[model samples]
Each structure stands twice: as structure tokens, then as C-alpha cells.
Target: MSAQAVDGLSRRGLLKFSVGATAFLATAGVTASLSGCSSSDTAPGFDALRTSDLPFLLAVIPVMLDGALTGIPSQSATERTLHGLDSGLSHLSPEMLKLTRQLFDVLGMAITRGPLTGIWSPWENAEPGQIRHFLGRWENSSLELLRQGHSSLLQLVLMAWYSQPQSWAGCGYPGPPKI
Candidate 1:
């Protein structure tokens, strides 16, 4: 309990050890949960994403691409965005796909999800305001992982939404040059 030493460890060393141990345990727990289910247990879907992940993306697309998605019916826009995201994900390298899958798994978990995303509700129940706040936090977070997650999601959503012909007019592209 003294600041000088505890057992054989200096107080500073002991504090460091405790922090490291806690982080290791937390990471192990998350990895175990993510790997607990076999591939066959997952609902069938795109090459990169499980069926459960689609709902999360559905919730995110409109919030991230609000301008492009405006005036488009929610259901149809969500469906098209999902398709575009899947197509884009399919072309990623295996390493990138693996990383993306891990990100989705973390977001899917109730434990890590709340702390990381600040959205305690399931994707379906999450309000657009809550999702937007979470996105903003991640985008502006000092942590590298949070920033990377925000970047990845934003890039994927923007690419998927803007690639559509319907979105072309929003940016004034006027359809693939006269070729």
C-alpha cells in the first residue's frame, strides 16, 4: 500500500504491471468471444460480412452519407449501400478483409461496443443522433484505433454511396465522360 514498494516491486512497477495485466485480460476476453462461434454458425452472406453486420452498416450508411442519401427512400438506399459496400469489401486484400471482419465483430459485441462506440443500443434501436455522435467521437478520438475505425467506415460508406449513378448529380459529375 505504501508508495515506495509492495512485495518485491516498486510502486510504479506494480502499477504498470496491473495496468498491463488488465489490458491483456480484456483483449483475451474479446478475442475469445469473437472466435467462439464457428463459421457454420454464422448466417450466410457476402464474402466479407456476416448477415448480422448488414444491419450495423445499414444504420451507419445514412448517417455517414446524409447528403447523398437525402430524398432517397430509406429502405432502397440502405439496400443499395449494403450492396455497394459488399462489392467494395470483396475486392479488399485478405489481410484487409480480416481486419475489417475483426472490426465488425468488436462492434457487434455488447461489452466492447459500448465503450468503443458510445452506443449502448443495438444498431436497429440506435437513433441517428446517437450514431452520428459515436461517429464524430471516433473520427476525432486521440486513440489511433478509434481514428482508424472511423476512417475505414467513412471511406467505405462514401465510396459506396458516391459510386452510384443516382449520387452522381449531387457532386455534378454528369456520368462517366463521353466514352
Candidate 2:
């Protein structure tokens, strides 16, 4: 929900296009499934998600804790990256989690139609290596928490995947070919 993302959304007709697209897709899906007319062709990615996708994503949050033992490390250069991602994802507000669930459902449906876009790649314009360094450590912290099991980390991880950009785009965006 950064201003930049909002800004990107507002440019030209993309904002309206995005919303309209989701409605079209969602309705088309319900229609096809109801008609029993091979909804499979209409919705492709959803079958793979299942409910487990939520739990798996949730698990990663706690795992991050185990990865970086020092909470807010003072000496390491990675401190900022770790802290930022941790802070970004760790706080799963109830409202956000609800939205994330809807997002997950939407992405799952989108995947059925095609590969997701604008979701996985971080939007910070950082080098792929840098984003990975940050997200990877965040994942590690989640992993540590996962080692403990049955923690809020699991729920948060689920929320993370649910809140993924790819998931949101699935509700609307037409993506590049998977090759």
C-alpha cells in the first residue's frame, strides 16, 4: 500500500482496468463452473493452491525468526533489510489478513488461467540480488519460527502469500507467457 504503488495504479486507465478485469474474471469463473462447461479452461492456477497455500506461506514468517537470531541486529549490515522485511510482514493486522485471504483466493483463480504477474518481484527497484538477500533472510527468520510450530508465525506466513502481488494481479492482470 505504498504511495508509489497507488501512484502506479492511478496512472491512465489502469486503475479502472484492473478493477474491471477482476470482476470479469470472477464472474466468468462462477458462470463457467455453474454451467459445468469445463471451468478448468477458464481457471487454471486455482487447483494448485488448495487451502494449504495459506498455511505454507504462514509457516515462512516464523521460519524467519529462526534464521536471524538477533532481533534488530546492531552490528550487521543486514540489520536494515532484516528489520524492514520483518516489520513489513510480521505485523499481520486483522483487516490486512482478511484482505490477504481474499487475495489468495483471487490469485489461485488467476493461476488457473495463467501465471501470475506483478506479484512475486518486489517493486522497490532493488537489484534482484538485494531483494533476495532481504526476502531470503526474512524467510529464514520465518523458518526459525516454524521450527517451533503452531505459532502465529504460521498464520502470518499464510497471510504473506495471501497478500502477494501475484495473487492480487491474478484477480485481474493478464500476465506474460510462462515459456
Candidate 3:
């Protein structure tokens, strides 16, 4: 467990591995987009999220929103939350939008998703527990990139859900002061 070697990997070897992984991720992202695996077409009725992103988004929304959808029908609530997310994303700067889409591509592409999130099944077929486990794992991951991805997903979902008027009462947030 010395600084020079941990788990039998030398510092230089670790550095090389990190660089290689970064290159792989960059290449995979470009390939995913150019190869059409990350569809450019928008999801049905969505302004920002792509068709390839819908399955992952649909699966994650309910799990992340959890108890917040109480009184509303799940389908209706999910659609509204998704629309909120879409609207929010539509306003992002081009760079931010590209990064967000890349995050979705990572989740949508099977090659990246399985290794990163450990969910090999198509997102449409993924169970809530499986999604929860992935989220928890990413949130607690030692990798800073995974942690940032977790934060981005959490922020998007939470902001989308809480922005809806119907959700305000659930969180005890009174509407903005009359001023």
C-alpha cells in the first residue's frame, strides 16, 4: 500500500491507465454520437432529450422523484417532470447542453452503461431497485467524474420535479411571496 505501488500497480502505471481511460471515454463518446447510437432525433414530444435518452430518463424519473408524485398519476407526473427537464435543458448554453447530452449518451449506450452503472438490461426493462443501486453507487463512487454525474442527474431530476406547482405542497414550499 505504499505511495509508489498500491495493489501492485506502480504510480506511472496508474497514470498511464488514467490517461488511457480518458482517451477511451472521449473516443467512445464521439463514436456513440457519430455512429448514430445516440440518436439525434428528439424523444417524442420532447424538445431537448433525444430518443436514445428517453428510456434512461423515463426509468430514472420515477425512482428519483419517489414519494413526490403521490397524488398525481404516475404517467402524467412523469411526463410533466420530463417536460420540465426538457424546457430547462433547452435554455442551457451550447457547451452545457453538449455535456448533458454526453451524460445521457453514456447512460443510454449499452457499452458504457453496463460498466459504469452495472445495469446490463435495457433501461426500459430495468427495475427501480436496480436504478436505485446504480444511482447510489455513482453517488458514492470514488471517481470524481462519477460523483459529478450523480450530482448532475440529481439536480436535473430534483429541479424538474420541484419546479412544478403541484409539487410545492409536498415539500412545504409556499409559492413565492405576493410581492
Q: Which model scores highest in lDDT?
A: 3
Best by TM-score: 3
lDDT of each: 0.72, 0.38, 0.86
Worst 10 residues of 3 by lDDT: 3-12
Count of backbone clashes, every candidate in sequence? 0, 26, 0
Candidate 2 local lDDT, 1-179, one digit each (tens): 99988788676466576566657645544554455432222122232223323332332333343343333332231323233333443355756543433433333343432322223432323344443344444345323321222234345444443344333343453555579
Question: How many clashing pairs in candidate 3?
Answer: 0
Model 2, stretches more than 4 Å misplaced?
Answer: 1-12, 21-50, 54-99, 109-115, 118-179
The segments of candidate 3 whose C-alpha lies over 4 angstroms from its true place after superposition are 1-18
Model 1: how far residue 50 lies from native, Å: 1.1
The local lDDT score (0 to 100) that residue 68 gets in candidate 3 is: 81
What TM-score does candidate 2 reach? 0.26
- Among all windows of 10 consecutive residues in model 1, the one with the lowest summed lDDT is 37-46
**What does candidate 1's lDDT look like per residue over 25-130, in tens digits?**
3574458445762131334656556775766787888788776654677677777777788888889997777677667767766666687778888888889999
lDDT of 3 by residue, 1-179 (tens): 67556745765676676677667666778888888888777877888888888899999999998888768877877888899999999999988988888889878889988988999999999999999999999899756677898999999988988899888887788988997
Question: Which of the two, 1 or 2, has more lDDT?
Answer: 1
The local lDDT score (0 to 100) that residue 85 gets in candidate 1 is 83
Q: Rank the candidates by lDDT, best first.
A: 3, 1, 2
